[model samples]
Target: MSVSLRVLDDGAWVSVNDSRQVSVSELWRLDAPEFCSCTVPDFVVENFQSVGVDGRTITANVYGQCIQCGETGVPGWIPVGRLKNGEYVDLDRENVVLPAHDGHEN
Candidate 1:
Protein backbone atom coordinates (compact mmCIF):
# COMPACT_ATOMS: atom_id res chain seq x y z
CA MET A 1 0.00 0.00 0.00
CA SER A 2 1.03 3.59 -0.61
CA VAL A 3 0.16 6.89 1.08
CA SER A 4 0.87 10.46 0.06
CA LEU A 5 2.18 12.63 2.88
CA ARG A 6 2.95 16.31 2.49
CA VAL A 7 3.42 19.53 4.38
CA LEU A 8 1.04 22.06 2.94
CA ASP A 9 -0.18 25.67 3.25
CA ASP A 10 3.23 27.09 4.11
CA GLY A 11 3.82 24.40 6.71
CA ALA A 12 0.46 24.86 8.35
CA TRP A 13 -1.09 21.54 7.50
CA VAL A 14 -0.26 17.86 7.01
CA SER A 15 -1.84 16.59 3.85
CA VAL A 16 -2.47 12.85 3.73
CA ASN A 17 -3.50 11.40 0.44
CA ASP A 18 -3.84 14.95 -0.90
CA SER A 19 -6.41 15.81 1.79
CA ARG A 20 -5.71 18.04 4.75
CA GLN A 21 -5.70 15.73 7.77
CA VAL A 22 -3.78 17.72 10.35
CA SER A 23 -3.24 21.39 11.01
CA VAL A 24 -1.34 23.80 13.20
CA SER A 25 -2.51 25.71 16.30
CA GLU A 26 -3.25 22.49 18.16
CA LEU A 27 -2.13 21.90 21.74
CA TRP A 28 -0.20 18.66 22.04
CA ARG A 29 1.24 17.08 25.17
CA LEU A 30 4.80 15.95 24.51
CA ASP A 31 7.41 13.88 26.32
CA ALA A 32 10.45 15.49 24.76
CA PRO A 33 13.12 16.24 27.35
CA GLU A 34 15.67 17.02 24.63
CA PHE A 35 13.45 19.83 23.39
CA CYS A 36 12.64 21.16 26.86
CA SER A 37 13.02 20.53 30.57
CA CYS A 38 9.36 20.20 31.31
CA THR A 39 8.26 16.75 32.44
CA VAL A 40 5.53 16.85 29.86
CA PRO A 41 5.77 19.91 27.73
CA ASP A 42 2.55 21.49 26.64
CA PHE A 43 3.40 21.93 22.96
CA VAL A 44 1.53 24.27 20.73
CA VAL A 45 1.76 23.19 17.12
CA GLU A 46 2.79 26.09 14.92
CA ASN A 47 3.85 24.42 11.68
CA PHE A 48 4.22 21.12 9.87
CA GLN A 49 7.78 21.24 8.68
CA SER A 50 7.67 17.77 7.17
CA VAL A 51 5.87 14.42 7.29
CA GLY A 52 6.79 10.76 6.84
CA VAL A 53 5.63 7.25 7.60
CA ASP A 54 7.41 4.72 9.81
CA GLY A 55 5.75 1.39 9.18
CA ARG A 56 2.10 2.12 10.01
CA THR A 57 2.79 5.25 12.00
CA ILE A 58 2.55 8.70 10.47
CA THR A 59 5.16 11.06 11.81
CA ALA A 60 5.83 14.78 11.41
CA ASN A 61 8.72 17.11 11.96
CA VAL A 62 6.87 19.95 13.64
CA TYR A 63 7.88 23.43 14.64
CA GLY A 64 6.24 24.50 17.86
CA GLN A 65 6.71 26.12 21.25
CA CYS A 66 6.60 24.48 24.63
CA ILE A 67 4.07 26.43 26.62
CA GLN A 68 5.62 25.30 29.93
CA CYS A 69 9.23 26.22 29.18
CA GLY A 70 8.81 28.48 26.12
CA GLU A 71 11.22 26.26 24.17
CA THR A 72 10.68 26.41 20.45
CA GLY A 73 12.01 24.12 17.71
CA VAL A 74 11.42 20.86 15.92
CA PRO A 75 11.28 18.07 18.51
CA GLY A 76 12.22 15.51 15.93
CA TRP A 77 9.67 13.29 14.21
CA ILE A 78 6.52 13.14 16.32
CA PRO A 79 3.94 10.53 15.67
CA VAL A 80 0.86 12.36 14.51
CA GLY A 81 -1.28 9.54 13.26
CA ARG A 82 -1.24 6.04 11.79
CA LEU A 83 -2.11 4.07 8.71
CA LYS A 84 -4.61 1.29 9.20
CA ASN A 85 -5.23 -0.92 6.19
CA GLY A 86 -3.94 1.89 3.98
CA GLU A 87 -6.29 4.46 5.55
CA TYR A 88 -5.21 7.31 7.72
CA VAL A 89 -6.34 7.14 11.33
CA ASP A 90 -6.13 10.15 13.57
CA LEU A 91 -4.33 9.86 16.86
CA ASP A 92 -5.64 11.46 20.06
CA ARG A 93 -2.78 13.93 19.89
CA GLU A 94 -4.30 16.53 22.13
CA ASN A 95 -5.12 14.19 24.97
CA VAL A 96 -2.11 11.91 24.85
CA VAL A 97 1.52 12.68 25.67
CA LEU A 98 3.34 12.02 22.40
CA PRO A 99 6.96 10.95 22.47
CA ALA A 100 9.41 12.44 19.97
CA HIS A 101 11.09 9.89 17.72
CA ASP A 102 14.69 10.64 16.85
CA GLY A 103 14.78 8.05 14.05
CA HIS A 104 14.68 5.09 16.45
CA GLU A 105 11.77 2.75 16.95
CA ASN A 106 9.62 3.46 19.98
Candidate 2:
Protein backbone atom coordinates (compact mmCIF):
# COMPACT_ATOMS: atom_id res chain seq x y z
CA MET A 1 0.00 0.00 0.00
CA SER A 2 0.97 3.66 -0.42
CA VAL A 3 0.69 6.58 1.98
CA SER A 4 1.18 10.34 1.98
CA LEU A 5 2.79 12.67 4.53
CA ARG A 6 3.49 16.35 5.10
CA VAL A 7 4.36 18.90 7.75
CA LEU A 8 1.53 20.70 9.49
CA ASP A 9 1.04 23.26 12.26
CA ASP A 10 4.25 24.97 11.39
CA GLY A 11 6.50 21.93 11.59
CA ALA A 12 4.78 20.70 14.72
CA TRP A 13 2.58 18.03 13.15
CA VAL A 14 3.07 15.20 10.69
CA SER A 15 -0.02 14.93 8.53
CA VAL A 16 -0.44 11.38 7.31
CA ASN A 17 -2.47 11.28 4.13
CA ASP A 18 -3.77 14.71 5.09
CA SER A 19 -4.48 13.60 8.65
CA ARG A 20 -2.47 14.53 11.67
CA GLN A 21 -0.42 11.57 12.91
CA VAL A 22 2.21 12.94 15.28
CA SER A 23 3.03 16.12 17.07
CA VAL A 24 6.52 17.62 17.41
CA SER A 25 5.44 20.12 20.06
CA GLU A 26 5.88 17.36 22.62
CA LEU A 27 9.06 15.86 24.05
CA TRP A 28 10.81 12.91 22.45
CA ARG A 29 14.05 10.93 22.55
CA LEU A 30 15.58 12.28 19.36
CA ASP A 31 17.97 9.55 18.18
CA ALA A 32 20.23 11.87 16.22
CA PRO A 33 23.58 11.63 17.92
CA GLU A 34 25.22 13.93 15.40
CA PHE A 35 23.03 16.89 16.36
CA CYS A 36 21.37 16.25 19.67
CA SER A 37 22.19 15.81 23.36
CA CYS A 38 18.59 14.77 24.19
CA THR A 39 19.67 13.05 27.43
CA VAL A 40 17.16 15.25 29.22
CA PRO A 41 13.96 15.27 27.12
CA ASP A 42 14.79 18.54 25.44
CA PHE A 43 14.36 18.29 21.70
CA VAL A 44 12.01 19.54 18.97
CA VAL A 45 11.67 19.01 15.25
CA GLU A 46 13.08 21.88 13.28
CA ASN A 47 12.37 20.42 9.81
CA PHE A 48 11.75 17.27 7.75
CA GLN A 49 12.27 15.79 4.28
CA SER A 50 11.94 12.71 2.04
CA VAL A 51 8.52 11.62 3.37
CA GLY A 52 6.88 8.58 1.80
CA VAL A 53 5.81 5.02 2.53
CA ASP A 54 7.34 1.61 2.03
CA GLY A 55 4.69 -1.13 1.82
CA ARG A 56 2.09 -0.13 4.40
CA THR A 57 4.57 1.60 6.63
CA ILE A 58 5.16 5.31 6.45
CA THR A 59 8.64 6.80 6.37
CA ALA A 60 10.28 10.22 6.27
CA ASN A 61 13.76 11.44 7.21
CA VAL A 62 13.73 14.28 9.73
CA TYR A 63 15.85 17.22 10.89
CA GLY A 64 15.61 18.57 14.40
CA GLN A 65 17.50 20.16 17.25
CA CYS A 66 18.06 20.10 21.00
CA ILE A 67 15.98 22.77 22.65
CA GLN A 68 18.54 23.06 25.40
CA CYS A 69 21.69 22.70 23.36
CA GLY A 70 20.47 24.70 20.33
CA GLU A 71 21.64 22.19 17.75
CA THR A 72 20.31 21.61 14.21
CA GLY A 73 20.56 19.28 11.20
CA VAL A 74 19.68 16.39 13.52
CA PRO A 75 18.74 13.43 11.39
CA GLY A 76 15.68 11.25 12.07
CA TRP A 77 12.35 10.00 10.64
CA ILE A 78 8.78 11.21 10.74
CA PRO A 79 6.30 8.46 11.56
CA VAL A 80 3.43 9.01 9.14
CA GLY A 81 1.29 6.14 10.40
CA ARG A 82 1.19 2.38 11.07
CA LEU A 83 -0.70 -0.74 10.08
CA LYS A 84 -2.89 -2.86 12.32
CA ASN A 85 -5.82 -5.37 12.43
CA GLY A 86 -4.66 -7.42 9.46
CA GLU A 87 -1.54 -9.26 10.42
CA TYR A 88 -1.37 -6.10 12.43
CA VAL A 89 1.82 -4.27 13.28
CA ASP A 90 3.28 -0.95 14.36
CA LEU A 91 5.73 0.46 11.85
CA ASP A 92 7.54 2.53 14.40
CA ARG A 93 8.61 -0.63 16.23
CA GLU A 94 10.19 -2.06 13.12
CA ASN A 95 13.98 -2.35 12.85
CA VAL A 96 14.26 -1.07 9.31
CA VAL A 97 15.50 2.42 8.64
CA LEU A 98 13.46 4.66 6.30
CA PRO A 99 16.26 7.17 6.18
CA ALA A 100 15.65 7.62 9.91
CA HIS A 101 13.05 7.85 12.74
CA ASP A 102 11.02 5.81 15.22
CA GLY A 103 7.69 7.62 14.88
CA HIS A 104 8.75 11.03 16.24
CA GLU A 105 5.72 10.78 18.55
CA ASN A 106 6.57 13.32 21.03
Candidate 3:
Protein backbone atom coordinates (compact mmCIF):
# COMPACT_ATOMS: atom_id res chain seq x y z
CA MET A 1 0.00 0.00 0.00
CA SER A 2 1.10 3.55 -0.75
CA VAL A 3 1.42 6.18 1.99
CA SER A 4 0.54 9.87 1.77
CA LEU A 5 1.40 12.73 4.08
CA ARG A 6 0.64 16.46 4.42
CA VAL A 7 1.75 19.29 6.62
CA LEU A 8 -1.15 20.87 8.46
CA ASP A 9 -1.27 23.95 10.72
CA ASP A 10 2.11 25.03 9.39
CA GLY A 11 4.00 21.90 10.43
CA ALA A 12 2.01 21.50 13.60
CA TRP A 13 0.76 18.15 12.36
CA VAL A 14 1.78 15.58 9.73
CA SER A 15 -1.27 13.86 8.29
CA VAL A 16 -0.31 10.36 7.17
CA ASN A 17 -3.03 8.46 5.35
CA ASP A 18 -5.54 11.07 6.53
CA SER A 19 -4.36 10.65 10.09
CA ARG A 20 -1.95 12.58 12.26
CA GLN A 21 1.01 10.27 12.80
CA VAL A 22 3.49 12.82 13.99
CA SER A 23 3.90 16.46 14.98
CA VAL A 24 6.47 19.18 14.39
CA SER A 25 7.46 19.28 18.04
CA GLU A 26 8.29 15.59 17.88
CA LEU A 27 10.42 16.09 14.80
CA TRP A 28 12.99 17.86 16.87
CA ARG A 29 13.79 14.54 18.47
CA LEU A 30 14.72 12.92 15.14
CA ASP A 31 18.41 12.85 14.36
CA ALA A 32 20.21 10.76 11.79
CA PRO A 33 23.87 11.42 11.08
CA GLU A 34 23.83 9.49 7.82
CA PHE A 35 20.87 11.40 6.36
CA CYS A 36 22.74 14.64 5.76
CA SER A 37 26.36 15.54 5.10
CA CYS A 38 26.37 17.96 7.99
CA THR A 39 28.13 17.45 11.33
CA VAL A 40 25.31 18.99 13.33
CA PRO A 41 24.32 17.09 16.43
CA ASP A 42 20.70 17.08 15.37
CA PHE A 43 18.44 18.68 12.77
CA VAL A 44 16.10 21.01 14.59
CA VAL A 45 12.96 20.73 12.54
CA GLU A 46 10.82 23.84 12.89
CA ASN A 47 8.53 23.42 9.91
CA PHE A 48 7.47 21.03 7.20
CA GLN A 49 8.54 22.48 3.89
CA SER A 50 7.02 19.71 1.81
CA VAL A 51 5.68 16.14 1.80
CA GLY A 52 5.59 13.32 -0.68
CA VAL A 53 4.78 9.62 -0.89
CA ASP A 54 7.38 7.17 -2.21
CA GLY A 55 5.99 3.70 -2.66
CA ARG A 56 5.07 2.40 0.79
CA THR A 57 7.18 4.99 2.58
CA ILE A 58 6.04 8.52 3.36
CA THR A 59 8.76 11.13 3.00
CA ALA A 60 8.79 14.56 4.57
CA ASN A 61 10.86 17.58 3.60
CA VAL A 62 11.55 19.32 6.82
CA TYR A 63 12.76 22.90 7.21
CA GLY A 64 14.89 23.60 10.21
CA GLN A 65 18.21 24.95 11.40
CA CYS A 66 21.14 22.82 12.46
CA ILE A 67 21.55 22.68 16.19
CA GLN A 68 25.33 22.99 15.89
CA CYS A 69 26.42 24.93 12.77
CA GLY A 70 23.15 26.87 12.48
CA GLU A 71 22.68 25.81 8.85
CA THR A 72 19.08 26.35 7.83
CA GLY A 73 16.79 24.87 5.16
CA VAL A 74 15.53 21.48 4.03
CA PRO A 75 18.57 19.25 3.94
CA GLY A 76 16.61 16.35 2.60
CA TRP A 77 13.76 13.91 3.23
CA ILE A 78 13.31 12.15 6.56
CA PRO A 79 10.86 9.43 7.56
CA VAL A 80 9.73 10.38 11.00
CA GLY A 81 6.17 8.97 11.01
CA ARG A 82 4.76 5.88 9.44
CA LEU A 83 1.61 3.79 9.13
CA LYS A 84 1.93 -0.01 8.91
CA ASN A 85 -0.88 -2.58 9.14
CA GLY A 86 -3.30 0.20 10.15
CA GLU A 87 -1.39 0.75 13.38
CA TYR A 88 0.10 4.08 14.41
CA VAL A 89 3.50 4.18 16.02
CA ASP A 90 4.26 6.84 18.57
CA LEU A 91 7.91 7.32 17.57
CA ASP A 92 9.70 5.71 14.67
CA ARG A 93 12.99 7.35 13.68
CA GLU A 94 15.09 4.23 13.47
CA ASN A 95 13.56 3.31 10.13
CA VAL A 96 14.70 6.59 8.55
CA VAL A 97 17.18 5.46 5.98
CA LEU A 98 18.52 7.94 3.46
CA PRO A 99 19.65 6.80 0.06
CA ALA A 100 23.35 7.06 -0.65
CA HIS A 101 24.29 10.41 -2.19
CA ASP A 102 27.37 10.08 -4.36
CA GLY A 103 27.38 13.78 -5.26
CA HIS A 104 25.37 13.00 -8.34
CA GLU A 105 21.73 13.53 -9.30
CA ASN A 106 19.65 12.07 -12.08
Candidate 4:
Protein backbone atom coordinates (compact mmCIF):
# COMPACT_ATOMS: atom_id res chain seq x y z
CA MET A 1 0.00 0.00 0.00
CA SER A 2 1.12 3.51 -0.80
CA VAL A 3 0.93 6.21 1.86
CA SER A 4 1.54 9.89 1.32
CA LEU A 5 3.47 11.40 4.22
CA ARG A 6 4.12 15.10 4.68
CA VAL A 7 5.16 17.67 7.27
CA LEU A 8 2.38 20.20 7.22
CA ASP A 9 1.53 23.62 8.68
CA ASP A 10 5.15 24.65 8.82
CA GLY A 11 6.19 21.59 10.78
CA ALA A 12 3.24 21.54 13.13
CA TRP A 13 1.50 18.48 11.80
CA VAL A 14 2.05 15.21 9.97
CA SER A 15 -0.17 14.66 6.97
CA VAL A 16 -0.92 11.07 6.14
CA ASN A 17 -2.77 10.31 2.94
CA ASP A 18 -3.60 13.98 2.49
CA SER A 19 -5.15 14.19 5.95
CA ARG A 20 -3.67 15.62 9.15
CA GLN A 21 -2.98 12.77 11.52
CA VAL A 22 -0.17 13.37 14.06
CA SER A 23 0.59 16.85 15.32
CA VAL A 24 3.05 18.83 17.38
CA SER A 25 2.58 20.71 20.70
CA GLU A 26 1.71 17.47 22.39
CA LEU A 27 3.67 16.31 25.42
CA TRP A 28 5.20 12.89 24.85
CA ARG A 29 7.04 10.64 27.27
CA LEU A 30 10.27 9.56 25.61
CA ASP A 31 12.76 6.82 26.38
CA ALA A 32 15.58 8.74 24.74
CA PRO A 33 18.78 8.73 26.69
CA GLU A 34 20.63 10.38 23.81
CA PHE A 35 18.25 13.33 23.99
CA CYS A 36 18.88 14.12 27.63
CA SER A 37 20.34 12.86 30.89
CA CYS A 38 16.97 11.98 32.34
CA THR A 39 16.05 8.30 32.31
CA VAL A 40 12.69 9.24 30.83
CA PRO A 41 12.24 12.68 29.45
CA ASP A 42 9.01 14.57 29.46
CA PHE A 43 9.20 15.75 25.87
CA VAL A 44 7.27 18.62 24.47
CA VAL A 45 6.85 18.25 20.74
CA GLU A 46 7.83 21.55 19.19
CA ASN A 47 8.11 20.63 15.52
CA PHE A 48 8.07 17.88 12.96
CA GLN A 49 11.29 18.06 11.01
CA SER A 50 10.40 15.20 8.70
CA VAL A 51 8.26 12.10 8.42
CA GLY A 52 8.62 8.61 6.99
CA VAL A 53 7.42 5.03 7.21
CA ASP A 54 9.34 2.02 8.44
CA GLY A 55 7.44 -1.12 7.56
CA ARG A 56 4.02 -0.48 9.12
CA THR A 57 5.29 2.11 11.59
CA ILE A 58 5.18 5.84 10.88
CA THR A 59 8.22 7.70 12.19
CA ALA A 60 9.24 11.33 12.41
CA ASN A 61 12.38 13.34 12.91
CA VAL A 62 11.14 15.53 15.73
CA TYR A 63 12.43 18.75 17.22
CA GLY A 64 11.40 19.09 20.81
CA GLN A 65 12.43 20.01 24.34
CA CYS A 66 12.85 17.88 27.41
CA ILE A 67 10.69 19.57 29.99
CA GLN A 68 12.66 17.97 32.79
CA CYS A 69 16.14 18.94 31.65
CA GLY A 70 15.42 21.74 29.15
CA GLU A 71 17.33 19.94 26.42
CA THR A 72 16.29 20.77 22.87
CA GLY A 73 17.07 19.07 19.58
CA VAL A 74 15.92 16.38 17.21
CA PRO A 75 15.66 13.19 19.25
CA GLY A 76 16.10 11.11 16.16
CA TRP A 77 13.33 9.05 14.57
CA ILE A 78 10.30 8.76 16.82
CA PRO A 79 7.36 6.55 16.01
CA VAL A 80 4.22 8.65 15.61
CA GLY A 81 1.72 6.23 14.27
CA ARG A 82 1.16 3.12 12.20
CA LEU A 83 -0.29 2.14 8.82
CA LYS A 84 -2.81 -0.65 8.99
CA ASN A 85 -5.05 -1.81 6.15
CA GLY A 86 -4.15 1.29 4.19
CA GLU A 87 -5.34 3.56 6.99
CA TYR A 88 -3.53 5.59 9.61
CA VAL A 89 -3.69 4.48 13.21
CA ASP A 90 -2.63 6.94 15.85
CA LEU A 91 -0.13 5.92 18.50
CA ASP A 92 -0.82 6.70 22.15
CA ARG A 93 1.92 9.26 22.18
CA GLU A 94 0.71 11.26 25.13
CA ASN A 95 0.22 8.37 27.47
CA VAL A 96 2.97 5.97 26.55
CA VAL A 97 6.77 6.12 26.56
CA LEU A 98 7.94 6.11 22.95
CA PRO A 99 11.42 4.97 22.10
CA ALA A 100 13.55 7.23 19.94
CA HIS A 101 15.80 5.39 17.52
CA ASP A 102 18.90 6.50 15.68
CA GLY A 103 18.32 7.51 12.07
CA HIS A 104 20.64 4.77 10.83
CA GLU A 105 18.57 2.00 12.37
CA ASN A 106 15.99 -0.06 10.48
Best-first order by lDDT: 4, 1, 3, 2
TM-score between model 2 and native: 0.53
**Poorest 10 consecutive residues by lDDT, candidate 1:** 97-106
Off by over 4 Å in 4: 104-106
Clashing residue pairs, backbone N/CA/C < 3 A, model 2: 62-76, 77-100, 77-101
Q: Candidate 1 has which clashing residue pairs, if any?
A: none
After TM-score superposition, what is the CA distance of residue 48 in candidate 2 from its true location, in Å? Answer: 3.8
Pairs that clash in candidate 4: none
Residue 58's lDDT within candidate 3 is 59
Per-residue CA lDDT of candidate 1, range 32-101, in tens? 8899889998999998888988889999999999998899998988999998888999999999999997
Clashes per candidate (backbone, < 3 Å): 0, 3, 0, 0
Order of quality (TM-score): 4, 1, 3, 2
RMSD after Cα superposition, model 4: 1.7
- lDDT score, residue 58, model 2? 61
Which 10 consecutive residues of model 3 have the lowest summed lDDT?
A: 97-106
- Using all chains and alpha carbons, the TM-scores for the candidates as numbered come to 0.95, 0.53, 0.64, 0.95
